[model samples]
Structures are given as C-alpha cells and as structure tokens.
Target: MAQQATPVRTARLGRALGPEPTAVSGAVLLLPAGEEISARRPSPLLATASVRALGRRLSRTGREDGLVAHVVHYRYRGWNGPEAHLAADADWAVEEVVRRYGDVTVCLVGVGMGGRAALRTAGHEAVNSVVALAPWLPEEDVAASPEPVKQLAGRRVLLVHGTNDERSDPELSFRLAARAKKANRDVCRFEVHTDGHGLRQYRDEVIALTEDFVMGAVFGRALSRPVQDALAAPPPLGLRMPLAAGFGRSLRH
Candidate 1:
C-alpha cells in the first residue's frame, strides 16, 4: 500500500497595498476565516474574498497615517484542534512584518476563525493591538482548550460581534471580552445589532470603527467616546457596548 502524503504548507503574506515598507510607520495584518478541521490547503475562501475588500479600504484610508496592510494566506484551512495551525501562521506573519519593516507597530485584523487566530497571536512583540470581527470563540471545554486571554496583556483588543450571528456565538465572544478586559483594561467588545456574522448591513460603519480602533492603537490617534468608554467601563457595560450607526461620519468630523 502507498503511504499517505502530507499536504504542502504555503502560509505566506499576500501582496500588500499601502505605503512603501521604508516609509511605513504602522501596519495591519488581515487574517481571513477558515474551517475547524482539515489538512488540505485552503483555496479561495468566501471569508478571504470579503476581507480583501476590507483590506483595500483599510490600506487606502490608512495611507495618511503611513500604514501598510497585508492579508495573510494560511497554509491550511482548518484550525486542527490543539495544533492551531492558523495561529502559528499568523505569528509567522507578524515576524515577517517585523523583519521587513523594522520596529513599526502592527495591528492584527481577523474575521471569524481568523479573529480567534489574531487573539491568540497578540503576544507577539510587534503586535500593538487587535481587531476581531465576529470572532468564532469556541465554548469552554477541556478538549477544545479554551483560548487564553493572558497573552493580551498590554495590547489593546477590540472585539466586534453581530447579535444575530449564528455561525459564531456572540455570547462566547462577550465572555472572552470580559475575561480579556479583566486581564487587560484596554480590551473592549462591541455589539452590532440586527446584523449577522457577515456584518454586511453596516459594513461601512464596521470598517470605520475598525479603522478608528486600529489607527488609535497603532498610531495613538484620538479614539471615539464609545471606544474610550468601553475600554474604561467595568464589566457588562464595557463588554456589551453598542456599535452605533453614523460612527464613520463621526470619525470624519
């Protein structure tokens, strides 16, 4: 019988859109969603398709701040249980950014499973903050090995979840935010009401909010009142902060 062949891993940073590396002051790493388990390398994922647009918008908007953005292409489609292959890929991407940019601040922006990976990789020295959009947080269980919050120390974390998200539990993200807030007072979670996992109904608002948070975290730009209050307020209030409409407009003025 022929032996099983291992799939070739191809985790790497895709083409970036932003200022030249030498001129960059800050950076954003975009991680797209993936499956829960599979060794096969990922093809073009729906999540990746959506994130590409977001990445372009971010790159364009953040240009004034000397921010460069890159989307990470994962080696595998699956989280692979404890193996956490996605997180490892994200970690490598961070190192790669550090290597190329040299001391510039980095923000990790991830959606769905990629959100979970961003949270997991926050401990990297180059990472200054994280933005998790509709992050998929698994229910606490011994086997699943609940995602740890200790790594988030000193790093600002923003978690955005849609209330109607069925694909990933909003409650789980709330719980994780609460835990992360306890560990690092800079943590906050926002609820996008009436939206689902995709957050398409208010994509502009979400992007604005994300841009605001990333810029603030990476470049020390002034943060909006809701974000500031969310970070300062104690549990329950902070963990359940509402994402309001016209937020992007507010940022503009």
Candidate 2:
C-alpha cells in the first residue's frame, strides 16, 4: 500500500502597517505548494510550514492576529544586476500586496541567496521586517556585490544560520550582524544545528523565532488602535504610483 502524505498545516493573519487598498490584511502559513526537487534545487528558504507556524505564533502575540499571510517567492538570477534592482523588486512586491489587501504588515523570510536578497530588500522604504535563514553575503576577497549591509542600519533584521554551512560561509552572516549591531541597529542572530546549511533540520525553532521578531517589530505596544483602524481603511488610489515606479526604475538605474 502507498503511504499517505503528511498533512500540511496552514495559518492566515491580517496586515497592520498602513492604510492602502492592496495592503494584505491577512496572512497564511503552511507547507510550500510545489513538489520538492532534489536537495540541490535553489528553492526559497522560508517554506510553507515555516509561514504557517510563524503566523500562528504571531497571532498569539495579539499584534498580527488577523493579518493575511501569503507565500512569497521571487525570481532567481545571478547577482550582477544594478545596485538597487533587488531592493526595488522587493518594494514593488510589498506595494502590490498592499494595493491588493490594504495597509498590512509584511514579513519576508529567506534562506541562502534568497536571504541575501531579503537583506537587500529589507532596507527599502516599504519593508516591515526581514528574516534571513542561512543567508550568504558577498565575500570581500572576491569581487563583491553591492553592499546592502548599510541599509540594515535602522531596520529589524533576523539572521539564522548553521555553523557547518559548506555552500556559503555562515560566518559571513555573523559578521554582517556584528556590523549591524556596531551601527546600533536592531538585529538578532540564531545559530541552529551545525550540520547543514538549509533550515530543514530546525524548522520549528526558526518559525517560532521569526514570528516573535515580526510581532515585536511591527506591532510594538506603542502602536495605537487609531493607527490600526487607519491601516484597515482604504488608501488614496493614485498616491502609490510614484512609489511603485520609483522602485522599479531604481533597479535599472
């Protein structure tokens, strides 16, 4: 007899960031929706289960209880694009989500190269929080990609990596976090089992940690109910144009 598939868990929540039409006011977390390829496939680090578990935990914090969470995926490519391309693309997605859902909180979770892209995008004006799992940063000894570490100065950043990453040096993320802390930024680090680079081994812990970080950053106790209500309301229709276009253009400039 064939074995039954493991049932995947899922969670949904609301957005709490701004008052806009497309803002995603809710979130969903569950197992990724696609077939699993070989271990070497370059998939996004934050899998479906990660999103669901994280969303559930965030709901408990009373901050993102109703926010809608959706699985987010970005195109993969070589990192030789313009300096602002990655950031712009990230901002555009955030805007698109807001335009569709209405002022909402956004949590971008990434691993490996995706983590690097998430860091680059975190500093954008539109991003709310960033969680990077086993992220890779450009090495100084090699031709370096544009450094996005500076943009992380004022943002909330979470870096999770294994000590035994062979594909990319985990120390790179540590050094990046150290630099961010040196600049007085809000950054957190989590070191998981030192046996692998991807987060498959420590999924639960990583999801819980990510949920806590997002709640703390996006819904700090200081946020007032009026702000929440305002975000829930509709946003001006055309005001978002420049923001979207500006971000798109930044990628090519």
Q: Pick the candidate with the highest TM-score.
A: 1
Candidates in order, TM-scores: namely 0.93, 0.60
Off by over 4 Å in 2: 1-64, 77-88, 142-146, 221-253
lDDT (Cα, tens digit) per residue for candidate 2, span 85-190? 3334455566666667566666666656557767776665656667777776667554655355777766766677776778767777766776666663456665
Off by over 4 Å in 1: 1-7, 18-22, 45-47, 142-145
| TM-score, prediction 2 | 0.60
Which candidate achieves the best lDDT against the true structure? 1
| Candidate 2 positional error at 169, Å | 1.2
